[model samples]
Target: MDIWKLGAIIWLFKSHVEGRAGIGKFLTSFVDNERKPTTVVFHGICWNNSVKLHVMKELSKAGIRSSQSMSKRTSLIDHTVLLLADLNCTGTDELIINASCIAQATQRELHRLPYRWLVLSDAPRSGRSSLWDPFLVDSELVLATVDGAGYTMTEVYKPSPTSPAILTPRGTFQHVLTDTRPHRELFRRRRDLMGVPLTITNTIQESNSSIYHLLQEDSLELEHDLISKNSYTLAKVAFLTLNATPVATFTNSFGYLQNGQWTGVIKELLEYNADIGTNVGMSQSRLKQVMFLDPLDNGRARFIFRQPALSVTANIFSLPFSPDVWIATGLSSFVAGVAYYLSTRLIKTRAEKGTVRDAYLLTMSALSQQGCEVQPRHVSARIVLWVVFTSMMALYAAYGANIVVLLQAPSTSVNSLATLAKSKLALGAADVNYNHFLFRASSDPVRNDIAKRVNSDKGPKAFYGLTEGVEKIRKGLFAFHSVVEPVYRQIDRTFQEKEKCDLMELDYIGYAAFHVPGSKKSPYLELLRVTFKRLREVGIKSAVNFRFEARRPSCKESIAMFSSVGITEMRPVLIFMAYGVALSVAVTAAELLVFHANRYRLRQRRVAVQLGRI
Candidate 1:
C-alpha cells in the first residue's frame, strides 16, 4: 500500500470508526435518494479512481450508467445525478448547479452529493486538489449553497484562463476533438503497447516555467500560460500516457559545467529509464546524444542582460558635433579674424598692433551676440565681419534646438551583446554549459567574444539556474544568457512601463525542442514526431507561445517621465557642466598668474638697469 493511499484510507474510514456516516448510512442515502440520478460521474483524484469505480458499480447493482469521461456522459445527463467521486472536500453536501447546454444541448440541471453523506476524501479539506481535473466547459457550478459535508465549488474551467475564457467558455470539451465522426468514447480507446508508459522526466513539481503547467496558486492549478502543458494534454488525448519523474537537468548538450552519474535528461532516455523527456531543448548537438520528437516549441538561445544603467555624461553641447566639426568651426573663425586684420592694413597705425585686438573683438562679439566696441572702417573688413556674423547666427539657432531636445526626451544609447561585453558589466548564464555551448556553435568572432564573456564568478559558482542569475541582473551590470520564455516571465514582473526600454534581448543562437532519447530505430520516436506536427499545425503549441509573446512586446512604456525632466534624468548633463565650469575657472586662474608674473619680472629687470646706471 502506498503511503498516500493508506493515509487516505485511514481518513476515509475515520468517519465510520467515529460513529459518523457509516457504510449503512452511505448505502441508504444513495439507492433511495430524493433526487434519483441515473448516471454518476467520477474524477479528480485518480489514485482512488479504481476503488471508487468498484463502489459505484455495486451501489447501482450494474444498472446505473456511470462514467469518468465527461464527453460520454454529456448525452446521458438530464435532471442529472452528478456523483462527483473522489472530490477532495470536507464532509458531504447536496448541491445544485445550472449547466448551460451548447448551441445543441438545452439547459440541464445537475445535482451532486456523496452516496455516503460523509468525508470520502483522501485528505482534509485543506489538502484537497485545488481545481477539478478534466475540462468543465460552458458549465458554471455555484456550490455556495449546499447541505451536509460534500463538494462545493464555483468552477469556470478551462485549464488556464485564456483571454477569451474570461468572458465566454463555449468550446467543444472532449478528450478527442478530432478522429471520429460524431466522436464517441473513441478517445477512450488506447492502443496496446504492452502497457508501456511514456516514462518522462520533468520539473513539474518545482518549476513554475508554465511549460509543464504545474503551477498552483490561489487555489488555481496550472495558472500560467504553458506550451509543455498543451503538448502533455495532447499526448494523453492521443492515447499516450506519461509517467513522470522529477529531474534537474532537462538535457545536457553542453557538459562543460554539469557532471556526475545523474547527468542530462537525455541520459535517462538513453538508458531506457525514461521513454520520453518533456521540456527537452532540441539542438543538433543534443540530437546526436539522443533523438527528439517533432519540435514542440523551438526557443532560441538569447541573452537577457540587465538594462544598461542610465548614462551620466552631460556633453549636450558637444554631442551635436564631432571633434572634426568643432575643429573646423574654430579654424574657420580664426581664419576670418586673420583675414579681417590683414585686409584692413591697420597694423601700421594700430597701437595694439601685436594683439590684433580689434579683429579678435569683431568676430568674438558677433559670436557672443554683443555689438563690437570698434567696427572696421575698411570695406573688406566689414564684408568679413558680415559673413562671420551670419554663420554664427545660423549655428546658434541649430545648437539651441538640439540642446532643447537633449534636455527634453533624451535618447538612449544603443544596447547590444557586443556593447555589453565591452562594458564593465560581466555576463552570467542560467546554465553554465550554455556559454561553452554557444561559443562552439558560433564561428563569428563577436559571438565567440560574447559567449566567453559570461562571468563565471572567477570560479565554479556559475549560476545553475535562471532565477539566481536574474537576481544579479536586477542589481545591475549583469547580462544573463537564457531562452525567451523564462526571461520574459522575469521581464514582465520586474520591469515597469517606463523601464521596458531597459529590458534587452538578442536573437536566439539556436532553437531548442522537446525530445525523447532514441535513434531513428526507436518506434516511439515516430509516434511523438507525428503528434508534434499535428499539435503544432492545429496551433495547440503555437497558441501558448503567442499568448506569452503578446503579453511581452518590445518596451512601449516611456522611459521619459510624464512630468518635466528631473535632475536624475539630467544626471549626465549636470556632471558635464560641473566639469566644464571647473576647467574654465582653472584655465582663467592659470592665465592670470602667468600674466602678473611676467609683468613683475619685467619691472624687476628695469629697476636693476636703473640701479646700475645710478
Candidate 2:
C-alpha cells in the first residue's frame, strides 16, 4: 500500500481505538441543522475502494453529501468543499499538474473553483515553490490537512505575485484522533488587505490615436480621454480604501476574443498576471470569461445632433395655416374673383369690361393689400370689391404672423428611432470597435436602415473621430452616434452656448453600465464590491464623473437670442418668385411668335391679290 493509504488505515484504527467520532465530529461542525448539509467532492488516483468506502461512511454519518466525481451540470452551491484524496504520493510538479486538471474541471462545471479544501496529505506547505500557486495565488481558501494521527487547519491566501501564500494557523488536533472541539469559521470574508500590493491592468489611448500605453501621469487632468481618466480615479480610490498598493499595467485593449483566444487585459487575468482589470465593460461574451464587479458608471452610446429646422421636416410656406383653413381661404378667394367678374358684366361700365384673367388679377392684388389700375364704376361692383378686400386683409395678417414663428421653430418629427431612420439627416458613427459591431450586427429593421444610411456610400467615410463628429453635429442636419461622455467633452469645448440649446440626443445602445472586471474566483471580489459601493454612496463616483463628463451647457442664451432666417427658410419664397419670372418670359415669347405669324399671313394675301391683277 502507499504511504497515504497506510496513514489512513492507522488513523482510522487510532480513532476507533480511542472511541472518538474521528472525521465525523469535525465534518458535522461545518453543517447547519436548519440548512442543507455542505457537499464534499473527492477525486484523485490515490483513493482505493476500501479507503473511499471508509471516508464515504464517515461523511454520511456527518450528514454531508460526498461525491467521487463532479457532474458538468452541478450547481455552484454544491461546490462547498473539495477533497484531494492523496497528494503526498505526488511531488510539487505532479501536484501542480493534478490540481490544474481539477481546477479546469471545477471551473468548467461551476465557472469557479471551491474555496474550501480538505486534503488527505500535508504536501502543500506555504512556501515559494509550493504546488498550490496556480489555484491559491491571489485567492483566499480554507485549507485542512490530515495525516495518520491528527489534522491541522489553516486559512491560505496570497496578497501579491511576489509574496508566497500566507498560511494563518487556525486549529490543530495532534494527540487525540478527533474531539468535540468546535470548528471556527474558516472563510470570514475579509475586506481590508493591510497595504498589500496588487497588479491592476488598464488601457490608455494617447493623443486621440489608436495606440495605447500605460498611464504614466499620476494626475487625471493630463489624460486625453474622459472615460480613461474617470476609470483611473475610481480604481485608485477603491483600491486605496482597501489599503492595497496597485501596480498599473497598460494594454492596447480592454480585451477582445481574437482567433479563439483572449487578448489584452483579459489575457492578463486568465494567465494570473493581473488581479484587477480597470474600466471594463460587462458585455455578455466577457462575463463568460471574467467576473464583473458592480457597475461604476451606467454608460450609453447615442445619436446626438442639432434639432433640424421646421422647413426640413415639412413645407414651411404651408405651415402658416392648417389644411382646413387653407381650403377655406382658397374657396373664398375663388368665389370673390368670380363674383367681381359677374358684377363687371352686370354693370357694363368703361372700367368694368373685365375678362376672367383680369378679375383674378384684381382679386390677387386686393389679397396682397396692393392697389390696381382697374376701378369699379357702379355700386354692386364697388360693394363686391370692398367685401373681398376686407376679408383678405384679416386672413393675410394671420398667415404672416404664423409664418414668422414657423421660420424660427425647430422640428420635433425625428424624435424616435423609427422617425430618425426615415429622416433626411446625414448619419455617421464614431470610428470605434463596438460601434461597428452594433450597427452591422443588429437584427432590427430600423437599426439596419440606420446602419445603411451611415454606410450610405458603403465606404469608410461614414465613420469619423470624436472631434470631426461633434463638428458635423454643430453644422446642422447631421446626426452622429457615439459614446456620450467623450463626445460631450468635445461639445463643451467647441460648441457655442446658443448652439447647445438646439443639441439633442437619442439613445442607441440602452443604458447598460461598465464595471471593473477581475479574474474568475478572485478572492478580493467581495471586498472590491464593498469598497466601490461605499465610494459611490459617498459621492466620490459622482465627483470623478464630473471631471470627465461635461455637463450640458446652460441654455441661458436661448431665451434672449434671435434665430436668423437662413436659405432653408427662404427657399419657398425664392421658388415662387422664379416661377413668376418664368411665366412672364413665356408669355412674351408667345406674343412675339403670334404677331410674326399674323404679319406673314397678311403679306402673303396681299402678294396673291397683286399677282391675280397682273
Q: Give per-residue lDDT, candidate 1, residue 196.
A: 40
Q: Write the per-residue lDDT of candidate 1 for residues 161-256, one digit (tens) a residue.
A: 221222221121121111122322211121223334444443332244543242221112322223344334444433342121222223333222
lDDT of 2 by residue, 1-614 (tens): 69999999999876653433354455544343214445666655354556566666877876678777654534455446554444554452454334544433543222224334544445446555454554433243445576445677665655544557666665555653332324332223345576776667766543543123224433334324445556666777787887888767767566878799998778988886776775666677888888787666545568998889998788899988889998888898899999999988876766458778878888989878898888777688789999999999998899889988887778889899898988888899988665655676367888878887776645655888888889999999999997676777788788888888877888766546667788764556656767788888999988767655666666768666668887878888888889989999999999999999999999999999999999
**RMSD in Å for model 1:** 23.0
Clashing pairs in 2: none
TM-score of each: 0.50, 0.71
lDDT at 513, model 1: 46
Tell how far residue 521 is off in model 1, in angstroms: 6.4
lDDT of 2: 0.68
Report lDDT (CA) for all predictions: 0.48, 0.68
The prediction achieving the highest lDDT against the true structure is 2
